[model samples]
Target: MRAGNVKRGVVGLVAGVVFAGLTTFSGASAETGGCGLVGTVGTPEIGVDDTNAGLETLPAAEIALPEQIYFRTSTESFNRRWSFAARDGRIYVKEAAAQGGWRSLPLPGCMEGRIAGVSADDDEVMAIDRDGWFFTMDHALSAPKDWNWSTRYGTPLWTGAGNTLPAGTLDWTWSVLSPNEDHVWRDTAGNDHPVGGAKVSHVFALVDGGCRIAYVDPWLPVDHSYELATPANGRFRAVKLSTSASTTLVVNRFGDLYTRLYDFDISGADKVFFRYSYEDQRGLREAPDMLSERVDSGTAAIQLPAPDWVRQPKVPGEITDRISVHKTGIGSDARELRIEGESGGRTGYWVKQLTDAAWRFVATDQPLAGTRLENTAADHSIDESIQPSPYSYAGRSAAGWTATVANFDISNTPTTLRVDVGNGERLDLILHMVDGLRQLPQQRGIGTQARRFDGTVEVPGDILGSLATQPDSIRQFVTSTLGGRRFTDTAVDVTVREFRIDGLSVTLGRS
Candidate 1:
């Protein structure tokens, strides 16, 4: 077998394992310039939602927030989310809860420009402004009074080497690439070399003029930067490839898209190498039949290019219309595969293995908009639907009354309530209450009889606004209906429900 073909075959296998979401990186060699990479896939957080202030003068920089952030010590826990953005000549860190609102960090005057490629983890955060300057912070806040901002390492534990571009580096930089960990760099008298040796993670400097798309990994030689053809007048702005797997999806400044099959070898314990399984640049739009017919009809989006091991079959009808696959969650333990579709005037979702060509139906009363095959030991998965109250709300009332509310929407329509009020008394009640809907009708004393209240009561505003207007309504209702049955505990538990799969949190014990 030809050496090139053999390398392709190996990479193809790795791609299959990555997209399959089945393998662990135990005993595998770690590649330099690849610390952020998970076992087969890095956390796939999409960043196509940032609003750009102006037109395409520079390449759009992208950054994704990690699933969780942890400090060195458990001094405090930040259950609330944190996000970073560059605007108005400053970098702002905003928490989900408006504790401090959006506050600016004390960025050194030198590192002032349009920020691109912002990445943060438990220990540190790194950002590169448009001018090719980088900044790092140990804590995600401004420098303290009389504190040294110049000495602050922009990226905690970052190998400060290779961060600053040499004098001959590009005059204007498009964006900075933020890898999960520091990349190892070798600068032999300004001639970059990836010569095989002990590799350390470090940053690569991209200049204005360059014709190479080089990365040291599974198969490429470390001696030189692999040169690739660029489109006419196309200046390289941003190049974000999937580090999670051996898949290559590159979008140029001209919006020209390309994909390649890349693979690496870590069999030589502590020594890793990478090569292109299929080195040919496969133009996605030109390559017909690479995806399902949905690709041509625009019904589906490409989530991940089919790995070589799981490429589309030549013959149709074998594996017909397939919805787009979406990568969800973070890290090895949190990664999930999901697919969504619309059929028969209803939206549906399915969970299928990366190796499985066919989609398996996910059973649900209402058609699910999407479903994620969570990476867990148990059969746990996240299901998405458009309908309000994807899951029934079951909680104990202040008086220890347990009930379940279904089809509930605090802002809109009424919901069906099944209440189980127990305290040496039994009252079975079914309620269909809506906004502004009042159930303060003539009440009956505690009895063994079953009664149902079906009426349109005005809840006025949203669940919070309406409830806030009448804070003691629940207690009042309970007391009035039960002839002065008062709540023993005055504290009310409030929980803010997060809808996003990755951001899902059910925090309790708040009054």
Candidate 2:
């Protein structure tokens, strides 16, 4: 398994499939106070996970730092095998020759062995193979004390050690040779540690998924991808709760949190739950108020459990003014989202800037704006799970406007789908764009932009929004009376974290 000096091949264009999970995350709170919740834009500090002074909330998203986990370890090491994930644990790096060899780490390239499987947070490790090529690495481990070589793709996993590459940020393209994945420090597992400890000398091994995005200090011009509302004075507006019966509700935002799901009115959609945002962190706060401008007052308590059919009476835990929400509100739902014992998923805030912050990856065709998440389908549920089944959380029969769908479509939108609801309770995410299914291409979605988009397509004030041009049936709406509201406020809980039905003068990526 030792034959890679270099092997690269990436030219994708299928458009669809995503999902995720996390137990404890830190960044959130850009603004969204009046108990309406929803922030993101210049800054809106103040964290919460259990607010309940009045009700209605879903404005939480923060924690995006140092992210580079570990990469830069190449020589082919047993050919190729490396995986990573950190918040607490998870790593793989196969090439063990034989023997049980499932849980390994002794990579240096040129070939070694040991990289089994299994790691949460949505998980990814592709390789594709055949010729089209395959390589997707991202679930980091940690290692960026700065170590410069010159720069093509190395420095900035969080940078430190030696430091280099910051000149223009280096886009480089078309590498002739000398690329990446050297993560350094490899005693060969003989002992120097790192077979599992020292965090495996900085994780990195993603193909097709390419994984590697950390390092955003480009002088901070700002535009890492934004769009936030409901926190000017605060009325809260980042909702979506699930249980799935079929009322609809899609909501999708990425990076830090705000992912919802639900689809099943008669099995036509049949996808019960896959949520995000359930805040109930207790005396939360330990660090993270990134502060651009936001330190509001009042509202922020959660413990939801209203009886009488459930209209918003929770009391499981939560209360906030956010000091740091106990070190960024600790969270974890492990077991890969166990309905039986595994875990679910949710890790958002719109992040994907590899090569370090200086951000640059726009090219599905480039030109097209963004925001394209059409809809349709009265009932839909998927989870063909032939074997490994441990993900479940989109279920509720009478929890007030509920929906937790995304068993799996692959039509696109598979970061792992997320949707949790438990704060002031008032989730009616009913995303029923009903019509064809998929026909993408207000710029792009399916073929000429076919159909079949499930959820996550929020782009109201974004003009340059590009995917192509946007024009797939065109029909955008988000009324609870825009913000006036009548009966659709819950202070938080509506997470889909990334979706697109496509085709309708589309173009999003502003905020």
Which candidate number has the best TM-score?
1
Q: What is the lDDT of candidate 1?
A: 0.27
Clashes of each: 34, 224
Candidate 1 lDDT trough over 10 residues, lowest sum: 498-507
Query: Which lDDT tens digits does candidate 1 get at residues 395-423?
Result: 55554655555443322222343445554
lDDT of 2 at 392: 28
Q: Candidate 1, which segments miss by more than 4 Å at Cα?
A: 1-80, 96-101, 112-117, 121-123, 139-511
Clashes of 2: 224
Model 2 quality (TM-score): 0.18
Query: lDDT per residue, candidate 2, 367-483, as tens digits?
Result: 211222211221112212222212223443232322343432222122232223334332223232211111111221112322342333222333113313433212112232223
